[model samples]
Target: MGIFDWKHWVVILIVVVLVFGTKKLKGLGSDIGESIKGFRKAMNDEEKPAEATTPPAATPLNQPTTIDAQAQKVEEPARKD
Candidate 1:
């Protein structure tokens, strides 16, 4: 029989469901669907040119900025033989 036969697929499906319970199977199905959706989204994204993407909002030049740093001096304990 050909691999695409309905009987073979039914048997395979039965075996899979038996090995993995219905709840687990449902989660697996959803996970697989999400993965496929993500893959398709990524593929579609690749078709768009980078230049077409929106640029980040510009920060105002007059905004105040902070540059802070702290320096702590520590002395090591004297070694004892």
Candidate 2:
């Protein structure tokens, strides 16, 4: 019998369905499709940063004028109850 015979296809399909149920096969197919879709999206996203965009401007760092900003620990006196 030829490999492309209808009986061969039917037997192979039946075996596959019995081994991995239809629900599982469907979920696996969708998962694989989603992964491939995400991969394509990520590849396309990288090209967006290649445009001639200016680097981010820096903001001035805050420097405290008073030594109080560099506070040292001071002990509190004990209060009588």
Candidate 3:
């Protein structure tokens, strides 16, 4: 028989269920199902184009501003021992 025969898989499945118990395995299966559903939803959403929306007008008092800055790394001079 091949390594991945149905009988071998069944034994492995039985051992896994015995080790982890059915309740935890059930919860794990549901969690996996939910994550997979969420992943598919995200993929479908990504495939759809986003609607263009205009930003609200900003008043001087409530307008947000950004500060631009640049950083440079300084190298220390090596001293001769």
lDDT of the candidates, in the order given = 0.94, 0.87, 0.92
The regions of model 1 sitting more than 4 angstroms off are 2-5, 55-81
Off by over 4 Å in 2: 1-7, 52-54, 59-81
Cα lDDT tens digits, model 2, 43-69, are 888778755676776656795444545
lDDT by residue (tens digit), candidate 1, 6-80: 998899999999999899999999999999999999999999998998888888899988889998999999999
lDDT: the better of candidates 2 and 3: 3
The TM-scores, one per candidate, come to 0.56, 0.52, 0.62
Q: Kindly indicate the candidate among 2 and 3 with the higher TM-score.
A: 3
Off by over 4 Å in 3: 52-81
- Please write out the lDDT profile of model 3 over residues 6-75, one tens digit for every residue: 9989999999999999999999999999999999999987887655445588669877888999989999
Put the candidates in lDDT order, highest first. 1, 3, 2
Supply candidate 3's per-residue lDDT for 65. 88
What TM value does model 3 have?
Answer: 0.62
lDDT for predicted candidate 1 compared with the true structure: 0.94
